[model samples]
Target: MTYVKDQSFKQDSLEISIAEPKDYFALLKPRVMYLVVLTALAGIMTAPGHVHGLIGFVSLLAIAVGAGASGALNMWYDADIDAIMTRTRTRPVPSGRITGDQALAFGLILSFASVFTLGLVANWLAASLLAFTIFFYAVIYTMWLKRWTPQNIVIGGAAGAFPPIVGCAAASGSITWDSVILFTIIFLWTPPHFWALAILKSQDYEEAGVPMMPNAKGLDRTRLEILIYSLLLAPVGVLPWLFGFASPVYGVLSIVSGLGFVALAWRVFQRRTGKPADSAAKGLFAYSILYLFLLFGVLVIETAGALILNRLG
Candidate 1:
């Protein structure tokens, strides 16, 4: 009887000790990873050179791992602030599902592995960009800027924007004007996207001591900045067509979408002075997400169509 009880207790303990795969997956921030992968694919497709199927697959996989690693590290470092913010309190590290040390180790290992593997499979330029992206997000943005300045997202946006450039390098072994335009679009789009959320979550940032735009610069100023960025992003979206990479279909979609984005931002600016301003800000935030997805979706379709044409020819 005693032996059986001890055996049963040990079995229960073992079950409790085992961590689910999903918890590790959560550490990767899968939603953000999806965007990174899609944008990187767009970069690869838009480039003016060819990449082998197997090599491209490996490079994309490596890029994804690196992006996930950066998210993990950001979570690890921001666990304190994340715990305080309602939006992030349930994340793996802050929720006590994973310890900071575990997240840190996971991030570091993934970062090193992804960068090294990318270099082995692709060019050093792609790998170097990946390494810099990881460092920028993990250290520059998460550790220092997020807590220190309102412009954190503005400059740190570069980290997220680098995927297309990295993809271009992986595909062509060099970056070009087209990749730079892709980079510019994302970089400019980030502020308005995030600032809208900030307007909605000023209290969260204040509680977490994060110097988000609304909190640091006042709500009115943040709204103006959001409108400014939206206006800037409008023209950048039309550049791929002018540069001669995208088709007329992409051009039409981009122009219409950019106008819609600016109109939403204008609403956000106008309504920001009142009440919660929840409706306006939330509307912009939601539409901004769809805007990016649609823009990139068009790019993906165009690239696919071009590939089909090339094969047929």
Candidate 2:
């Protein structure tokens, strides 16, 4: 007996809650979009400029809407494979909560609305980038890369990595070293973070006919790549401090967290002796998300602290 904000289409439409905003929000994948919006805001906040509160709110909203649109489109396109993968089988499209056509229409309408609103409220450049991001994730990543090559996540990672840049562009209308650095950090971080999951979920993917790194390359090779990328991610994570953008707090946290990430990779690489080979990979996969969240969280807090210090000064 969930209530609908509006009428919804479902058997026992009474059994389904149409009025609750949560269900529709779930179709938008708000949890995933929250991370996207946070990272994007961090990039915008850390950059050397000021965004007005109203404009900033609209900008974030537009980016968020665009992200949701992308998720809907992704779910729409991947509904078939999603139905097969246990991890994704419960998604709105696959679980009978939302139809693929409904998702497609929802995504397209939101995509256009977000872009048009952003361009009207902010700038065309950012709006255009948002449009491209939605298309990139929905089409390039979900539709093509996910099924074609083991390098799927590697290339597909770019879709997720674009949000920060889009936020930066929304704020400043152009790219900067700082913005590009933020993009670089996320871009480089994506491969290893996802490959960890791929390693563990190789079977899930192979069964679904998706070519992830672990399936394309051997497990040992994938582990090596994860270690390598993690090493790169550690130093890149600290570029804010390297470029004098933040205080030493960021540098210290980045170094410590980065080291921890590398250590986790090492553990997975060497001590992978017990349980299914998937266990070690799964451990790395889960930890990698924590690592990135912590890494970015530190940067966001560090920047906010600096803003307060400057305000006091």
Candidate 3:
């Protein structure tokens, strides 16, 4: 009877110790990771030289892991506020599926492993950039700027913009104007994209005490700021073509998409009350995602097509 009781206790303990794999995956913030991978691929493809298949694969994997590590750390650190916000209450750390300690450990371990692997397979410059990116997002953005200032997303946007630069460095062992252009485009795109969502979720941010633009500066101010960023982003989005890396097709697509972004922002700026306002913000937020994906997708497609043509020639 004693032996059976002990065996049952051990089994229960073992089961309790195991967490669901999907919960762990959620800590990685896979949606954010997907964007990181896409921008990083564009960086690699647009760089000046060819990368070996194995090296390119390894570098991208390392960057993805590093981005995941940053996400995990962000979730761990923000778990307290996350629980207070409706938008984030269901995340792994806040939902009771993952403990803070577990997330911190997971993030730290992955951060070290990714930087080391990237340095081994690519150049240290790329690895160092990845390390800085993780640190910036986890420490600077999450621990400091996010709660302290309304301009958090503006400054913290650099972390998201670094992936392309890292990818470019990994492929060419150096940063170039092309990579900087990619970085600039994403950096400019972040504020308008996030501010649009902030308009819709300002109440959640206020309750959580996060100083998002809409909460800190009022909805009117946030709307104006979004419009301004969209205007700036329009011309910057066309830079790759002007720099000679992208074709006229990309230029035309960028101009048209940029105009659409500005138009959406203008609607958000004009609609200031009730369902109209919410719908406009929602529309801008959704279109911002599509706009970014379209621009980067075109760049990747053009690069791939050129490479194929050269191979056949």
Candidate 4:
């Protein structure tokens, strides 16, 4: 499918949009938003302070909206490239279900609303961090790094890693080492997790002129880098347990999951051709998502349980 540079005639022809609620919601990139909410919740619950239920709920809602705003803006700005890539060609803006102007307006409104709401309900530190995250993703990453460099995912990963820090600030009005560690885990996890998918989607990226690792660097280099990052991620993933913030249960689960992540990365690194290689990359991609979800999910559960037990005691 080809993307037309000028949508003026098409816009005049349509006059009325055929978009539905789900089409607009699709612009929010809900899957990524879910991960942001989960990691942020873990940060909020694990931080060393008591946050009132209503305040906590509002803070989380504001953070979610901020994340959604980032997603919308990213889609708006990347519509041309999105139209070129098979995986993203059907996205709301690229598919003409939502106009770029509408998406920009929606994203800008949500960005302002989320930041202002968080500042009023929580603290300004959290609000500031949320605002920065949106700007970094929409402007710095989406507009610049993504098309300019192969390290796009590596550097751009910072935007995705900020949610937990924002949550910690909202809950305690300060950034703790615990929240930083949460940020670190996600930061380290991003390269391998995304590079694995990049290995699989190299052609799509090449066609779209996005400088993803596998497209810019050779696949062998990307695979090796994926393994290296996976190795780093495994040990760091165990830090919360080692530091005593999380229980032994989390420690054991983290070790097991971390090992599994490395094993998948190794598989990707070893398989160098054809269907076997593609399958390996796909396995690593899928397992990487599960690996992160398990770690944060278990951390939240363990931390919340400990808090409840402490209050009872």
Q: How many clashes (backbone N, Cα, C below 3 Å) per candidate? A: 0, 5, 0, 0
Candidate 3 stretches with Cα past 4 Å from truth are 1-15
Model 3: what TM-score? Answer: 0.95
What C-alpha lDDT, on a 0 to 100 scale, does residue 127 get in candidate 3?
94
Off by over 4 Å in 2: 1-20, 276-279
Winner of 2 and 4 under lDDT: 4
lDDT string for model 2 (168-283, tens) is 88888876788778788888888888887777677888888887777777778888888888888889989878998767887898888888888888877775555755676677
lDDT of 4 by residue, 61-170 (tens): 99998999999999999999999999999999999889999999999999999999999999999999999999999999999999999999899999999999999999
Residue pairs in collision within model 3 = none
Worst 10-residue lDDT window, candidate 3: 8-17
Work out the TM-score per prediction.
Answer: 0.94, 0.90, 0.95, 0.95
**lDDT by residue for model 1 (1-313), tens:** 3345344354544423244679888899999899899889889989887788899989999999999999999999999999999999999888888888888999999999999999999999999999999999999999889999999999999999999999999989999999999999999999999999998899999998899999998998998999999999999999999899998888999999999999999988888556647898999999988988887888978898889898999
Task: Report the alpha-carbon TM-score of model 1 versus the true structure.
Answer: 0.94
lDDT of each: 0.91, 0.82, 0.95, 0.94
Best by lDDT: 3
Q: What is the lDDT of residue 279 in candidate 1?
A: 91
Give the lDDT of residue 145 in candidate 2.
78
